[model samples]
Target: MLLGLAGNSCIGHILRCFRAKTHSSFTSPINSFQFSRSIYCATMASAAAGETRTEPVYFSDTYLFSFDKASVLKAEKLEGDSNDYAVVTDQTIMHPQGGGQPSDQGEITTSVDGTDVVFQVKQVSKAKDSQEIKHIGCFSSGSAELLPVGQTVKMTINEDMRRLHARLHSAGHLLDTALNRLNASDLIPSKGYHFADGPYVEYIGNVANEERDKLMASMNEVLSDLVKENIATQITVGDSGERIVSIAGLPCPCGGTHVKSTAEIGPMKVTRMKKNKKNMKMSYSLESS
Candidate 1:
């Protein structure tokens, strides 16, 4: 995990790294937002108007890895690119690169005229203020078939990478709970970079220099015990419509995917603590599973 300060920018692309069922039914712990059991249709009118939104299935089920029924909305071959193409789907299990978590790497597969075609998804991203998620990559070599818009395809994300991202994201929240246990709950959370390069959480508050060492040691102890207790993560609807994730019953407003339980987060250690101005950035890591 990333050890850099929370405010440090994450590299746009990680060096080589890192879904499930169509219409899969997953009931979150809270009666927040109910997801449709089918892909949202992009009307021809909207497609003609160049407007389409992807239904993010990962929001409802973080553990789902393979989705069998995602319809391709558009496939455009780049003009000056090296056999590169961009694809958009009606529904996706791929988590786009955002919110400090990295984009999911995977492949989209579909058969055309009794021949198999694959689009290797190298990066997933969504435009700012847009719901459409674009999968950018190239068709597997030897075949230059572009997926027809409206053709059904299957999506399978790299499960190991997804799990690692979930673990990292969850570990960040666990640190928040540790702060509360340390009686430093007054520190306002400012930024969290859960990227694998060096995950860290920054708080806009201060702890005395003399007390810092004790705090880090105690924080690690609390995190170890929390993992041992194997507390299940809970999701509940807040007064507003936001999804509130509670790790070990400590609530935080978060949109990133997370592990199912604290145990799944494995062992986490606060590797470094730095006080930058009024901000305290705590870098951490989790044991590899």
Candidate 2:
């Protein structure tokens, strides 16, 4: 759903900073595009060659912004692009776009002819039915150096952008918490669009039109109080290898990165609410800190 932020001029620059200029056919969330068949095959073949799956360091340590030695496994120029490339590495701290959160963007630096070169990581994604994560972008040296297989590279994500995304994601969950706390058991959360422009959570149920105003105000107040409490964010893995996240001591399965605590989510508000017969959308935004 498109958000109408007509009067919020300040939010315009923030949205621009996070917006990705992509050339894919369908473009909403930048990193969820489909890779070509050949690109997909190459990635799966590399995985079947007995190398281990890409190590997702972000799953273990969300605060780790840089890693010194990530071995490049496969790098190829994406189809229909002159200089754009798709890179697969032995491991990544860059979280691929999934689970309602946006992909992390930064640079992958490696030495070329005794000088440093960089691959600008604009989009990171998993192939439609594969577990392989592809880092898609162009190189600072153009196509002169598509990182060679087995080349060691240094990876760094934009720390500010990462923090903003994490906070926005956690704030969405926090809004869910507020709903439950306020005893709105009827609204069942089913989808979350945590993109920076207008992050919102969609639910499977509806609220009465007459009560929307009062309920929204209550949600905002509860969210504010919860943030002030400085509730720590907790992540635990279940026996089946599922990651469970908890804020305000209520747990839910999640795979996205998050802030260290709810306090990091400064202020949140349920800015707008829309409901049809069978579903509802609760639009929310974090107050600029």
Candidate 3:
């Protein structure tokens, strides 16, 4: 079954950000692609020698970096189900859905001796370890090419998809900040919260209907100001340590990419509000001009 975004509200925003970019902009990197291929080969050889390292898992970390296109080492497809899959590259620019975020969508292309052979990518997932990662793509019916183990391949993510998911994920952070501030100023204690996909965000606690309205209005007002979204230095802490990134007046620990400014979010509208158990649910959507 296709994973639903119902209870997983926080990831909804990420899906939106990544779903908006154009894939064509990610042509093979400009410098000699062969150099990247050599690096990929070398990396694979090292891994074969039993050197183990943590693969950087977020696409945002490497999306903007230009490297020899061949740096990505292809791995064998260890396992897969119908919808989810696992694939390992010498390195990757795809972010899996973990830590309350969604995964990415893109294609992996393999060339045989400088000639394009096959291209396909339906969905991506991470394996339990870096060594046995697999990428699952939906191939056209009766397609002949099968991605054999050790085949030299070039992988590219749908750039627009990454951008959209990033935007929504960042916006969700802003929403959390808004809720925290409103609750604090009003003397309401927040009990729980989640930012549903698209614009539906909810915070659970002892907040009155009037307070919810006020909070929404205040957030909209802040959005109107179009504050800039800055990349604060990433501070990684122990699992129990406090992590914080402030956008507008909100601060929290966030390990996701965001737009440079809030104004880029365009206009936001709160469409629905309700209560679930002791928690409140607020649904919203972005207004496109």
Candidate 2 collision pairs: none
| Model 2, backbone clash pairs (residues 3+ apart or across chains), number | 0
- When sorted by lDDT, best at the front, the candidate numbers are 1, 2, 3
Please identify model 3 stretches exceeding 4 Å from their true place.
1-54, 57-86, 127-134, 139-152, 180-197, 226-245
Query: Each prediction's Cα lDDT score?
Result: 0.71, 0.69, 0.44
Per-residue lDDT tens digits for candidate 3, residues 85-147, read 234454555555543445566766655545554435565554332332345564332122334
lDDT of 2 by residue, 2-78 (tens): 01111111112212211222212222211111211222233345445564446565765677899976898888878
Alpha-carbon TM-score of each model against the true structure: 0.81, 0.80, 0.60
Ranking by TM-score: 1, 2, 3
Residue 2, candidate 3: C-alpha displacement in angstroms:
24
RMSD of each: 8.2, 11.6, 10.2
